[model samples]
Target: MTEWWLWMYVAAMAGGVVLFTRWRADPCGVPLSEYRVAIAIPLWSGFWYLVMALGGGRAEVAGHTLYWARYADWVVTSPLLLVALTLTATHSLPGRRWGLMSTLVGANVVVILGGLAAELTADATARYTLYAIGVLALLAVYGLIWGPLRAHAHRQPKEIAAVYREAALLLSVLWVGYPLFWLIGPAGAGLISSATTSLLFVLLSILTKVGWSIVDLGRLRSLSGRGRLTVV
Candidate 1:
C-alpha cells in the first residue's frame, strides 16, 4: 500500500505537470466556445496533483490521511463525468464515440463513489479493487473512442475537435496504462515493483498531458498565423 501510494503520487505529479504546462501556454486562451472544457482540464489535473500530495488511499497511523485523500482524489476526477456529458451534448461526437465516453465516465463515476462509500462504511478491499479494475477497463475503452475521434478531428482544419481529441486521447491512454500495471504485475512483486510501476505510470501520464499541451500549442500557433489578435 505504501509503495502503491508512492507510485500513484508520481503518476499524479506527471499528469499535473503536463496539464499546468499547457495551461501556461494558454492554448485555448482566456475564453472560447469550449472555455469550460478547456479550463476544467487543468483544474482536474491540478486536483490530481493535490490528491497525490495529500497521499491518497494509504493507511496512515491515524488513517485520516488516506481517508481524506481518497475522497479528494475521487472528487477531483468526478468532473470527468460532467465533461464527457457536455461533450456528448454538443452532438459533435459520433454516436459510438458519445456512447462510449458517456458509458465510461458514467460507470466509472458510479463505481468510484460507490467504492468510496463502501470503504468508509464497510472497509471492503475486494470491492475497491474490483471497482478499480472496472475503472481501468473503462479507461481502456476511452482510449478506443479517442483514437477514432482523433482521426475524425484531424480530417478537419481549424476546429477545436482535434485539440480536444488529442487531450482526451492522452488522458485516456495514460490512465489505461496505469491500471494495466496493477492487473499484469506479478502476485508478489512487492515494494520494488510497485514503486517502479507507480513511477512509470506517473511519467507516462505526465508525458501524455505534455503531449496534449504541445498539440494545443501548435493549434494556437496556427490560429495566430491567421492574424495577430490581442486578448480583450
Candidate 2:
C-alpha cells in the first residue's frame, strides 16, 4: 500500500474536477456564479498534490516524513476552503462581506499548520501541546460557527439558516478528526498504516469538500427556487 496515498490523491482530484466542471456548466449567474474560484482552488490543489506525490516528492528528517506537495496544496486550498465557507455563510447575511470568516479562518490556518508541525516534532510533550492548541482552535471555530455564524444565519430565512447550519455542522464534524489524523500519521502516536491514513485522508477531503459544496448547492436551489440535485 505504499501508493495508497497516491491513489487517494488521484481519486480526489478526478472527482473534484468532474464536480467543478458540472458546476461551471450550470447557468446560475447571480451568486453561485461568483464562487467559481472558491470551489475551484481545492480541485486544482488536489491535482497538484497528486502530481507531486506521483512524481516522488517527499522528504524525511529526523524520523519524520513530509509530503511537500501536500503542504503546498494546503497553502492554497486551505485559504480557499475558508473563503468558500465564509462566502456560503455570508450568503444569507444582509450586507456582510467577509463575515467572521476572516478571523476564524485565519486562526484555523494557523492551528492546522501548527498541528502539522507538532506531528513532525519528536518531542512528545510538544506534540501533545500542539495538539491541544489545535483542539482549542477548533473549539473557537465551533464557537464562531454556532455563535456568530449561527446568529447571522438565523437572521436570514429558514432555508438559508438551514444551509448555514448544515454547512457548519458538516465542517465541524469533518475537521474534528484532522488533529487526530495528524497524530496517527507518520508523525502521530496512533501509528496507523500508510494505506489506512491515506484512506482516511480521502474520506476526510471528500466528505468535507463535497459535503460543503452540496450544502451550498442546496442553498442555491433555495435562492433560485429550484429542486434538489443529486450532484452539484
Candidate 3:
C-alpha cells in the first residue's frame, strides 16, 4: 500500500533519531536518566511504524476509516513515552512518589489501549463507550500530574525543578494530540486521510520523542557537566 511506503519514511526518520539521541547522550557527560527510557520509546516506535507500513490493518465504520497498525504500535510505544516523562519529571521524587507514578502510568496504558480498542470496533455504542473510558483514564493521568507529581517537582532543586516543570508541560501538551487527532483523523470521522494522519504522527514523534530527548540531554549535561544542576 502507498500508506505503507509513507510510513516507511516516517519509521526511517524515527530510527535515525534513535541513533542520533544515543550518539548525543554519551557526550552530555551526565548520567541522563532519560536516555535509557527515551531510547526504548523510539526503538519500539520505529519497529511498529515499520511493521504497520509493511503489514498494517484497516477498518471503516460510519464513514470513519483507519489504517490501524498504528494502534498496535501505540499499545507498546505509548506507555514507554509516559514512563520517560514520569521519570524525567520526577527526577527527585521521593520513594512514595514512585508508587503514585506507577499507578498513573498504569492508567495511561489503559487510556491508550482503550483507544486502540475503540478504533478496532465498528459498533457506535461500543466505540463511544470505549472512547469515554479512555478519556476518563487519560484525565486521571492529568490529575496526577497536577496533584502529587507537581508537589514533588516543585520541591526539587530550583533549576532541576524548572527542567522537570518544562518537561511536564511538554508531556501534557504533546500527548493531548492523541485524542484530538483520533476524533478528527481518518480513524474516527474521516476528516483527514491516512497520509495526513501519518504526517501528523511523524511531526508529533519529532516533537515529543526527539524533542524531549534533546531537552533531557541538555538537562543532564547541566547537572553533570557544568555543576550548575541541582537535586535534593
Top-lDDT structure, candidate number: 3
In the range 1-232, model 2's lDDT, one tens digit per residue, is 2566666766766676676667667635326533575457657666765665565556774376666566566656666666666656666455555647687777777777776677567788987887788778778777877887777667666666676677777777787776778777766765886557656866776666655676666466556655332112
After TM-score superposition, the amount by which residue 106's alpha carbon in candidate 2 deviates from its true location, in angstroms, is 1.2
Question: Model 3, which residues run further than 4 Å from truth?
Answer: 4-29, 55-66, 93-96, 230-232
Q: Estimate the TM-score of every prediction.
A: 0.50, 0.83, 0.83
Candidate 2 has an lDDT of 0.66
lDDT of each: 0.47, 0.66, 0.70
User: How does model 1 fare in lDDT?
Assistant: 0.47
Model 1 per-residue lDDT tens digits across residues 34-68: 33454455455546555555555444331222233
10: Cα error in model 3, Å: 4.4
lDDT for position 141 in model 3: 89
Pick out the ten consecutive residues of candidate 1 with the lowest summed lDDT: 182-191
Clash list (residue pairs), candidate 3: none
